[model samples]
Target: MSTLGVNTGWRARAACRDHDPELFFPTAHSGPARAAQAAAAKRVCAGCPVREACLRFALAHLPHGVAGGLDEDERRAVRRRGAVGRPVARPGPRVLARRARAGGCSAAQVAMWLGVSTRTVHRWTAGGAA
Candidate 1:
């Protein structure tokens, strides 16, 4: 099954499929070592047929790895700039309700977790808003 709405069939055509997975997950701090590893992984991505799809998936899911020739920092820049011309995904009302029920949390607590106003959470719970 596809994870995070990504098409896993693309993996078969990815150039990095046979490479070391570590090359895609560099440390947080930037340095020569990280740069080299990321560059190597990017080289593979540059030749992959599904590079665009991989990047889109990474941007949507915020995965921790090099994808579509971009490392974490590059992906963060894309997200911050909204370069993809698509709105970032947000948790829907059903997700909020599930979290509240699973955690036995109140609307305010759910709002805090969702980074939305408590009134928004209340509205969602009442089915007046998403």
Candidate 2:
């Protein structure tokens, strides 16, 4: 038994009516028309009850597809600014080594602490002073 007969209605539509590419894809003008469509998509997402869920599902499953009214750029930005309460990681070894050396830890000692080669430590020291 397929659920294709179910009447999902406009409420379940992912994109806004105004921004629906179905309307614009055929007759859209040049840049201006595309911009208008993007704006419309964002507006629909702004007040959508299922916005987050829609976005999450889109990103998790169809990472290449736009959903919840967001295009690729908007969805990427949303994912980049995620606020799920986890702390951000600091910069990598070169940055850490420079900071440590600046704070007076010798290159070898910093290497020992960080478990990296002394050549790496020297490279960081050289890069930082540049």
Best by TM-score: 1
Candidates in order, TM-scores: namely 0.58, 0.36
| Pairs with backbone N, CA or C atoms under 3 Å apart (clashes), candidate 1 | none
Task: Give the per-residue lDDT digits (tens) of candidate 2, residues 6-108.
Answer: 3234435544444545532323443434434443444556667765555555554445434555565545665688832333233465775676677666777
State in Å the error of residue 87, model 1: 15
Off by over 4 Å in 1: 85-130
lDDT of 1 by residue, 87-122 (tens): 434345466445453445666656655567888776
User: What's the residue-level lDDT of 117 in candidate 2?
Assistant: 92
Instruction: Estimate every model's Cα lDDT from 0 to 1.
Output: 0.67, 0.54
**RMSD (CA, Å), each prediction:** 15.8, 17.1
